[model samples]
Target: MQNSIFKTAEVTDYIVQWLKDYALTSGVKGYVIGISGGIDSAVTSVLCAQTGLPVLCVEMPIHQAPSHVSRAKEHIAFLQNKFSNVQAVEADLTPAFETFKNAVPPSDNENLLNLTLANTRARLRMTALYYFAGLHQSLVAGTGNKIEDFGVGFFTKYGDGGVDVSPIADLMKSEVKAIGKYLQIPTSIIQAKPTDGLFGDDRSDEDQLGANYDELEEAMLAFENGIQATNLTGRKREVFDIFCRLNRINQHKINPIPVCKIPKELK
Candidate 1:
């Protein structure tokens, strides 16, 4: 399945309008976004700013790498300079993370402990975003794209996934880049490798997923179109398997929360 072509200008306009409509209907003043110095967050913040409403760009760094921190600051500065309604704040989460680390019991499984800590960072950021949202009467706008949110479920549940509105959830990573370029997002950010910044390392999303966004996108599209993997071979087959495995394992994140239904007779 081929990726859909979209005009950046038209799509941008549509998203900005949709944001405005949602905010107006929900009675919120604006949006609060946690900028991660990645392409998705930068694009989402810009889209939110384009709505001509108050946009709070929060930088929540939990022992974040220098490069990620710099890129996030650069994006926030760019947004503030370009959009009058854009505001910026930094919630240094390193200390909070350390405190939480001391509180949790030690685990013999280092890998599990590291993964759990990484997810805890994301959830901490989510908490910070909501704090600002509640203080400012704004909605927490999500930065997830199509591949991450639906294809592979590559987000922390109740963390980055816990958002009031998703402005770019439907757009693919490539599509988000196109929109980012159209919006003239900082060149440094536009070219930077995608990373979740949860592990406080230079490792990228590709490093974690074992497949790049483009590869993942292709596999996702193919799977959605019911393309049989039996005919695939080599790298394509590997990527398809990775996508399938992630999609299967992360269904709990992608789908609505399960609710046990009571039988009518029980009432």
Candidate 2:
């Protein structure tokens, strides 16, 4: 069964009020978010708009698929019609990304080069969001979910993860979708397959992550609760193994960087 803890109206109200309180107390004139035409961004943008603060939804398409861009615009239109404080803007970073890619010498290692380029795109989008946020005296609200940000480190450091505030960072992917439906987010966006929109090859998030969000979230919960992998068998054991391996490999993203402390004598 899908996680149902966050499906309540109270959770929705709590998040909306939380965004309102944070923006008001911080004295930010508004909030800015990168609208990726996915459920996560859709839910996040709606929450920010519900705060009645000026919400800037930026469509930063850097070599993005045409359908994704269309859906983003559609969502933006929906928000504009629903909330007076909501505004949409487009910051196409294609040329900028091209310049950055061209600056780097061609590599024989295609996978490494592609990975580096994908991360560059994410960072570029982050920069664009901040640029608008600065102009409006707003905060950059992130669209990350718990499983992606904390569970598997699916986000790039200082890329999509670079934000002034994260309103839904604790919710899982399923929870985000549930909230999306509650928020009356456009059906197209709510049902669209999740993607980072980073890879030029059009690889879906599932293709890159190996396992889907449901399996990942289950593994994350089990791991957090001290569930032993040895206790599982058959398909359960296989999924657990994948989660453990990914968690071990991606711990650096979730953990703080190591600092070598010098002893008093050395100092």
Candidate 3:
């Protein structure tokens, strides 16, 4: 049974402990987060800052991103003021994205453009992030929440998921909202409409998944709870199928690769 009342401090403690555990496991010295002005990233920024490691917040906005680029920077500024170890850096990916678009003209392989273009943008941002991470000698932190991670294999493989540590990948969207409030994150961030801002004109993640966060979260939780009765309708079911497929296909994303090698003696 799921807990009815989500405890704030309990969630915050989990996040803090996640940061500590990552430090111990990776033997890394510090942390880095990409602040897209979204709630999950905002919340993760605060948690990583509180972990007492040097937290480098990178703002990588492309041409299509709305004015939230500045809004994101403002939030980072606030975090910087509050957290002594926080440092703000900017890496504009607009030029890089455009270069990629031009350099890799449309191919006969349509999926390449649809899939690869998206991956290109993601890799560009992380490309800039890797430079900063190397300079800061910090681990790249991921902000994907459980709901998004479950839907449509929603992220580009080896792109956005590329990171040294992910603190909230286990928390659902609803749980993340609760965690944000507990951490005293700005209500503006908490209430903002959901979007990936990958393309302009209010294009959002839900538009991509054909599933909303509420249903996605519920279905994902239901799947985890071992209940097979839960299901979606029409296009929504299609989205759930994507979620299920990704979960089954990408189990390796969350674990180390398995290798079965023969010892010379056995051979």
Off by over 4 Å in 1: 1-4
The C-alpha lDDT values of all candidates are: 0.93, 0.86, 0.76
Clashes of 1: 0
Q: List clash counts for every candidate, in order.
A: 0, 0, 0
Q: Is candidate 1 or candidate 2 better by TM-score?
A: 1
Candidates arranged by TM-score, highest first: 1, 2, 3
What is the number of residue pairs that collide in model 3? 0
Error of 1 at 236 (Å): 0.6
* Ten contiguous residues minimizing lDDT sum, candidate 1: 1-10
The candidate maximizing TM-score is 1
Considering every candidate listed, which one attains the maximal lDDT?
1
lDDT of 3 by residue, 1-267 (tens): 224786768878877987977786877778888888878899889999988888899988776566567558768977977999898888888887888788765788886566667677777877788889898888899989876654435675567778777788877788788888777777777887777766544666777666677767766765777755354576556656766776677676644657999999998
| Candidate 2 lDDT by residue in tens digits, 177-196 | 88888778888987787888
lDDT of 1 at 100: 97
Q: Which stretches of candidate 3 lie over 4 Å from their true place?
A: 24-27, 108-112, 150-152, 229-242, 245-267
